[model samples]
Target: MKLLLDFFPIVLFFVAFKLWGIYVATGVAIAATVAQIAWLRYSTGKVEPMQWLSLGIIVVFGGATILAHDETFIKWKPTVLYWLMGGALAIGLLGFRKNLLKSVMGAQLELPETAWRAMTWSWVLFFAVMGVLNLWVAFHFDTATWVNFKLFGGLGLMAVFVIGQALYLGRYVKDGKEVPVEKP
Candidate 1:
């Protein structure tokens, strides 16, 4: 359910792009993102920081795409978002000595400092690579192909990365319990 909610705007955008075109799809994406945020705020009494960032990016880039009659702004949106997230994680880990990934997921999973650091760094690299990938696709392909890649290829890569992360973390689990890491 949460996953579907997260992809709501993208799914709508893809459908709109197929049915209409880029400008119409951009409008649909903007409206869908705004609606998603409003629904989340109304239902949960708050929205996550990432969700708010997504809303801001969509509104700015999608608005530009529509108003200026250029699809380039929309095409760059994903790269900007990914880079921003990666930068935030990198800054939190390097500059502040805080693992933002652990801070968020700590309540759900018990892991050693080493594991947390590895996970955080992996995410940082993933986002950085994803940002570059988005740009590569956006520039190298046609608008329709980029739109297809945005929905399918982007999501496919994310799913694969997540599965790989889970497999990597699987080693830390033993007999239904988290294995404790020994201190050096």
Candidate 2:
């Protein structure tokens, strides 16, 4: 499924870290991301911009970690990517007066303009907080703790955030017939 495909790289990175170490994990992560992109391209006939950005960040930070024999670069990668996403969304909203979330999902979900802006800002704030939290864990804890946080804590928080978003947005559905899209 799409969720499994989306998480493949992170899962591989966790496994590799547990078996080997950060250096080996970094290599595995890079390879897995590359493979993910390739699979997406082959199946969808195109790669999303976010995927390209992730690949670029991993290669740059992971490559630096390998070449310099420093784990700091790899530790910074997640925070960098998170901040970039938040920044992009913020800029789209404030600079261009656009709600990117609405633009992307508007076809599927109809909602009022206020609800659209609220959702976009919610994601922006989430990304910002996540970025800061990643940095905090990366610096305050040891490698093992950081890796655990990255794999478990990060994913858990994301799942919760997404579920919360869906629930909140459901209240403002323009169709006036709210229904759960996924089976419980």
Candidate closest to the true structure, highest lDDT: 1
Candidate 2 Cα outliers beyond 4 Å, as residue runs: 174-184
- Point out the worst 10-residue segment of candidate 1 by lDDT: 175-184
User: Pairs clashing in candidate 2?
Assistant: none
RMSD of each: 1.2, 4.6
RMSD in angstroms between candidate 2 and the native structure over all alpha carbons: 4.6
Query: Candidate 1's residue-wise lDDT over 1-184, tens digit each?
Result: 7788899999999999999999999999999999999999998898999999999999999999999999999999999999999999999999999999988998988888988999989999999999999999999999999999999999999999999999999999998888877766
- lDDT by residue (1-184, candidate 2, tens digit) is 9889989999999999999999999999999999999999999899879889999999999999999989999999999999999898899999999888877887887777777788888988999999999999999999999999999999999999999998898786547674434423
Error of 1 at 75 (Å): 0.4
Give residue 125's error in model 2 in angstroms: 0.7
